[model samples]
Target: MGKLYVVGIGPGGLEHMTAKAKEAIEKSEVIVGYTKYIDFIEPLIKDKEIVSTGMKGEVERCEKALEIAKEKVVSIVSTGDAGIYGMAGLILEMKKDEEVEIIPGITASSSAASVLGSPLMHDNCNISLSDLMTPYELIKKRVELASEGDFVISLYNPRSHGRPHYLRECIDIIKKYRKGNTPVGVVKNALRDGQEISLFTLENFDDSIVDMFSIVIVGNSGSYIKDGKFVTPRGYSL
Candidate 1:
């Protein structure tokens, strides 16, 4: 039987690609991913066959990769950590008769949080604002609950075409349970080229600045900005 490596390529840069991930890609005869992600690794994979897909075609892409892997060694690539809102879940769901190996990489949330200090040091939850598969009401409910529980939130897929208002709604919901002065940080294309970081308060979150590539971190009431970095004290060193 052929082997399959489900690899995470990190956020964007070639430097971020883990050695194991690169080795897996090099050993594989087929590399599969979204077009944007595939483009990021194009230079590394010169002789391999690339199978890429458009947006919202994750399942189809994975299925195609699996079919090809049955005959040839294949590597399915995802940006950031494969387990966190990445291709890990889909690949697992699609794997029935095949044995797959997952090679992990840095998650965007982790990278973003590291750059902005430590907003996730305390109790925190990661939420995705994209409602393509989930209903808006459900997303709102999750945000509301997380806010009421005083959990810092790391939001993914915060903004995109035809879904510009979701992030604003998330901010509004969190504001109702938390203070208007709560710290919020936006990290765009974290750890990648043209990376940008923006800090603001819950009351002043700039909706105009967010995009699909951005990750928005909303801190709890205990969170604060120190020297331009947003931090939530973990109480470990207190």
Candidate 2:
């Protein structure tokens, strides 16, 4: 029976690749991933069979990877952590065989938060603004609940060409339950080249400056900016 390893390659740097992930990639006979992600790990995979897909088509991509996995040891690569808004979910949904191994990597939100201190030190929830599969109404509802419950939110797929105003709409929903002075942080391409971190308040967030490469984190009412870092007290110190 062939085995499949779903590896998270980290954001976009070779140094970020975990030892386990690199070992898996090196041992695998076949590698599958989006073209960009494939490029990120190309240096590590010199002679491995590679199959890459364009953006979108995640379900189809997983299906094809699984089909190949049934024949040989295959690795499906995802940027950042595999479990968080990565290929793991799609792979699990299409997986009939339970013999797959999941290798984790640093998620962009956590990495971004690290660069800005610990924004998720307290309770937090992650929401993707993309409505490719889910309904926009549901996304709005989740954002509203996250705000009302005072949970710090890490937003993924905050903006794209198809949904230009998605992040703006999310900010509006959040403001309905939180104050205008609520702290928000934007991290673009975290841990990768061209990385940018910006600190701002909910009232002053500029949607035009954000894109799909960025992760937007909105702090709760109790969250604050200290020493140029966004943080939420976990009550452990209290």
Candidate 3:
């Protein structure tokens, strides 16, 4: 039996890539991941066996990595924190009798929040709008509840080409609980090349500006913008 390391690369930046994550891949005999994630760490994985799969091939990739790890150490890479929408869960679920290690990296919400402002200072929840595995109704309910609870929301997989309306629908539901002027921050390609960040309001944010790669941080009722920064104060004055 061999060891399997589930690593998160953290938004494609070498600096954002944790040292442990890099070391896991460096020490591994095989690296398995989606093509994009594999390429993100291509520089550190020279001469290593890379088994990259295409989109929606996570299960195949993880299984293949585990099979290879049967004799040699393997590293399976995910984009953000391995536990948060990464390969950690799948790998653990599929771990029949192998030593599975999860090396977490900073998740998108945390990194994006840093880039945008202090929108996640208080109670917050990170929700993905992908709807690939999660039902849309359930996602909507989560959004509504998060909104009603006055928790800041970090939305992942907000707007894809096929699911363009998901982000808009989610924002609409959130607006029912939040004021129309509620602060919203959009961070695209966070911390990666071609990064973009912008601030908008609940009623004015155009869905066209976002894509699958974007993370939208919608502020709670008490959230506000200070000096062009989106901020959700943590009772500092109370």
Question: In candidate 2, how many clashes are counted?
Answer: 0
> Which residue runs does candidate 1 get wrong by more than 4 Å?
none
Instruction: Please count the clashing residue pairs in each candidate, in the order shown.
Output: 0, 0, 0
Ranking by TM-score: 3, 1, 2
Give the per-residue lDDT of model 2 (tens digit) for 1-238.
7788999989879998899999889889999999999998888887999898998868878998899888799999999988988899889888997468999998888888988788998889999999987899999999988889989999999998999988898899888988888889999999888999999999888888899999999998888898988888888755
lDDT minimum window of 10 residues, candidate 1 = 229-238
**Against the true structure, candidate 2 has what lDDT?**
0.89
Query: What is candidate 3's local distance difference test score?
Result: 0.91
Highest TM-score against the true fold, candidate: 3
Which 10 residues in a row give candidate 2 its minimum summed lDDT?
229-238
TM-score of each: 0.95, 0.95, 0.97
Query: How much lDDT does candidate 1 score?
Result: 0.90
Query: Cα deviation of 75 in candidate 3 (Å)?
Result: 0.4
Tell how far residue 54 is off in model 1, in angstroms: 1.5
Please identify model 2 stretches exceeding 4 Å from their true place: none
Mind giving the per-residue lDDT tens digits that candidate 1 earns over 1-238?
7878999999879998899999999999999999999999989998889899998899998899889878889999999988888888888888888779999998888889988999999888888888887898999999999999999999999998889888888888898888888899999999988899999999888989999889999999899989988989888764
